[model samples]
Target: MDLLTPDLGLFIWNLLAFLILFFILKKTAWKPILKSLNEREKGISDSLATAEKVKAEMAQLKSENEALLAKAREERAALLKEARDTKDKIINEAKDQAKLEAGKIITDARAAIEQQKMAAITEVKNQVGNLVIEVSEKILRRELSNKSEQEKYIKDLANEVKLN
Candidate 1:
């Protein structure tokens, strides 16, 4: 019973000390603690907003990269097509040039062959004329060995010419 019951003067003094301590803490520490908590909240919100902005920029950059890649692919295809066309054109031109060159060579060869044939014919005719002259000279020398034989051969040639 004595422990449970407090003296009035002690109770009044304890209450006064607690009230003074509470007021002192409120006046000295409350405003700074509240200001620190508000600053921390604002920093967190700013960080989150910055992160969202960065994420949006990354998405836009990814789309731009994809567009650039598509354009590069199209350019590559066009360049390859142009290269193939150029190659075909060059090959066709070379083939046409080869055909013309071959035709010119054939024409030149034919002309050369025809010229050689005419030359051979002329040579054969000249050789035949020379052989005929040599044979007639020998025959006349043998037949005209005596004057009487020469006269008889001349009379025979005249008679043959008259019959023809």
Candidate 2:
């Protein structure tokens, strides 16, 4: 109970000292503390704003990258398709040329075979005609040895011709 109640004179002295200290701190420390706090708050806010801006730019760049990738894929697909078409066209042309060459070869072979057959037939006929002429000449030489036999054979041939 005694410690809880202070003397009036002591209370007055303590109040006076507190007022002096308060005024001194207000003039010297308050402004600097408040200014430092405000500067820290401003710096924090600026950092947050910069982070948000960077995040937005990153999102935009990501979208741009996706668009470029899609375009590249489309171009690659088109190029592959064109290459396939070109390959097919070249293969078809080669096949068609091969067929033409085969047909031409067959036609030439047939024409050559026909020409060889005709040449064989003409040679056989010429050989037969020459043999017949030689046999007839030999028979005539043997039968018509003198003029009397030739005249007798001519009379017999003329008489046989009249009867037929």
Candidate 3:
């Protein structure tokens, strides 16, 4: 049992050695080690703060981008609507022009038909007049071939003229 326990002399020697070592380490290494640990902790804190700031900026940028995208969509929709309206207006204008053209064509056709009808009637009247003149000339020539018939025809013309 005595061999298993520590001796007083040995304990005193160990205590002195421990105190000397503690003083030496405190003077040489403790300050620098503590300062380095503190600096490391400060760096970590600053990095975390920077990360938080960056996250906030990213969120703000994302929101702004979304707003711009929405604006773009609205503008695109407006442009499309304007294009459709313009197309409709152009189509309606073309329809109106076509209708006008059709009306003019119909009017022209009617005028041509009227002129053709007048021309046909004039041609028929001229033919009838010519036929009447030819028949009168033939009858006159046949009657004037004899002197007695000519004398009789002249006396008949004189009496008819005096009566009129």
- The C-alpha RMSD of each candidate to the native structure, in angstroms, is 8.9, 9.4, 8.8
Best model number under TM-score: 3
Q: In angstroms, how far off is 153's CA in candidate 3?
A: 19
lDDT of 2 by residue, 26-131 (tens): 9999999999999999999999999999999999999999999999999999999999999999999999999999999999999999999999888878776776
Q: What is the TM-score of each candidate against the true structure?
A: 0.69, 0.68, 0.74
Per-residue lDDT of candidate 3, residues 1-164 (tens digit) = 98999999999999999999999999999999999999999999999999999999999999999999999999999999999999999999999999999999999999999999999899988876776676566557664678888777766654543211
- The residue pairs found clashing in candidate 1 are none
106-161 per-residue lDDT for model 1 (tens digits)? 99999999999999888888776766565556557675678888777766654544
Residue 159, candidate 2: C-alpha displacement in angstroms: 34
Off by over 4 Å in 3: 1-15, 144-164
Locate the minimum summed-lDDT window of 10 residues in model 1: 155-164
